[model samples]
Target: MSDTLTTIGFDADDTLWHNERFFALTQSHFAELLADHTDHETLMQRLLEAERRNLPHYGFGIKGFTLSMIETAIEVTDGHAPASVIAEILNAGRDMLSHAVELLPHAAEAVEHLRRQYKVIVITKGDLLDQERKLAQSGLRDLFHGIEIVSAKTPEVYARIFNAYGTGADQGMMVGNAMASDVVPMIAAGGWGVHVPHGLSWEIEHAATPEHKRYHEIPDLAHLPKLIETLTQGQINATS
Candidate 1:
């Protein structure tokens, strides 16, 4: 274990469990309800655009997600959707949003492994209430030493977290899913980062990767413990 890596931060949503996939499935069901007026792809695009517009108002959460689906459903339907279709859309969105909470495979094990040797912190951006509820439901809420639920994950956020934890850039590592929201800012803040790409990421987060030595990309949560062990081993070797 690396004594140099005193603190490690993790992303919550897609990093710890299934998130955007649920939204995508809900959106698919929602688009089906409005297929008479708009196709699924078009409906999804408009909803993404709408979400970009609504971010300032809603932050991040299922409430905003469901609202975006309803907004897009109404917009695409051109006011001609039957009450049944609208009800179905609402119910489907709500059902998915209220999805039974569970942890991703290996999330618990990886966290346990890291926590044994380092200060494990969760740095996630989302609606505070929704995030808290999910964390509570996932049954891993007690595992983390520090939790950062923020409105955004930017370089500033990374810097603040590093400073608060009293760790320099070399001693702090970030693990998250979105390149745009997670890796980019951590790199910009001069911190090391691990990218665990989700199966479905937001279109906006699909940006060109900036080259950096401290960045490591892994396939999924199952590989995380090994990756961390390797990185931590290197850090330990360097210090010793």
Candidate 2:
């Protein structure tokens, strides 16, 4: 919350709102459906690994994720499962597409508060249509002054966003849930980043721990505005 910074970028999905729960629920089904072949913990690990490997290839979103889950289930099951099992897995994928995305607690309040003082924008990755649909459905879409739908978050992504907002990295801040995808790259681009962890965040996101001096971690969205206020006040105190 640098008052000097006119623009603040926020990550969509799990950051500002709820996401990943669909994947988690689907995963539970995977474990149960394939109970004879794999346990929940092992299945979870494999799914996580598969997602990591698939990120580069699939970018982000439900389509690639669904495919990955199905692929992993088939691979781990070794083609021995009955056809009905595969059909059920496919059905689960369909159900995920229809699952509703929810806004995290205090998200709308934080966004409303921040928008009054900062140029709020959303930076997120995923399939274009689904991401767009979720945003429109989120009811918080209007709270953001702008929307950035990125296929992936990289150092370059941060650079572009900073440049677009006409601010240097130090003047900018990124709020996100995923340490690797949302915070790390933004921090590398010279911005302060806040991470709000979700209970069912994607595996790839949970792999990295928050350790950078510029990186701050919070339990959930309810504390985000307070953290931003603290950050902004700290900067003010140092300058004074």
Candidate 3:
């Protein structure tokens, strides 16, 4: 919330609403589906590996994850997984897509508070259709000034977003749960990075804890406004 920070970007999924929890539940179901072929631990490992391998091709979101699960099932069962198992996996993905959007505690309050003082936007990466559907269902969509559903969250991607919004890197702040996709890359692009930890995180989105001076870690969304106030009032330097 430095004086220069005219725009604040938020990550949509876990940062604003309950996302990873659904994935975790779905994963458990997936483990169950493959239990006959392999134990839970090994199936989970295989699924993780499949996800990592498919990321570049399918990108991020439920569709890609569902496909990876199918692929993993095929591999684990030597391409002999039953039609019923494949159907279950597909249904799981559909259910996830249609699941109700539940906002995290204080998410609406935090976004409302920040919107009053800043040009708040959502910069999230995932399947465009699914992300858009979630935003539409979130009931917080109108609170944001803009929404960006991107293919990735690299530094260059962020730089373009900031440029499009007419905010410089130093004049932007990114708040989200993932250190890998949300905080570090945005910080590397010269923006302030605020990390709000979600209880569960996708393994592929994990990264080393950042130690940059411009990086800040807040417990949750409720603490955001105070942190912004501190930065803007010069009570603390953004680079501190």
Best by lDDT: 3
* Best candidate, TM-score: 3
| Residue 219 CA displacement from its true place in model 1, Å | 1.8
- What lDDT, from 0 to 1, does candidate 3 have? 0.91
The lDDT values for all models are: 0.80, 0.79, 0.91
The per-prediction CA RMSD against the true structure, in angstroms, equals 2.6, 2.5, 2.3
Report the poorest 10 consecutive residues by lDDT, candidate 3. 231-240
Per-residue lDDT over 166-194 for candidate 3, one digit per residue giving the tens place of the 0 to 100 score: 47767899999999999999999889999
Misplaced by over 4 Å in model 1 are 1-3, 79-84, 166-170, 236-240
Model 1, span 122-168: residue lDDT tens: 99887787788889998888999988899888888888987787475
Scored against the true structure, residue 108 in model 3 reaches a CA lDDT of 94
TM per candidate: 0.89, 0.88, 0.95
Candidate 2 off by > 4 Å: 1-3, 207-211
Ranking by TM-score: 3, 1, 2
Spell out the clash pairs found in candidate 1. Answer: none
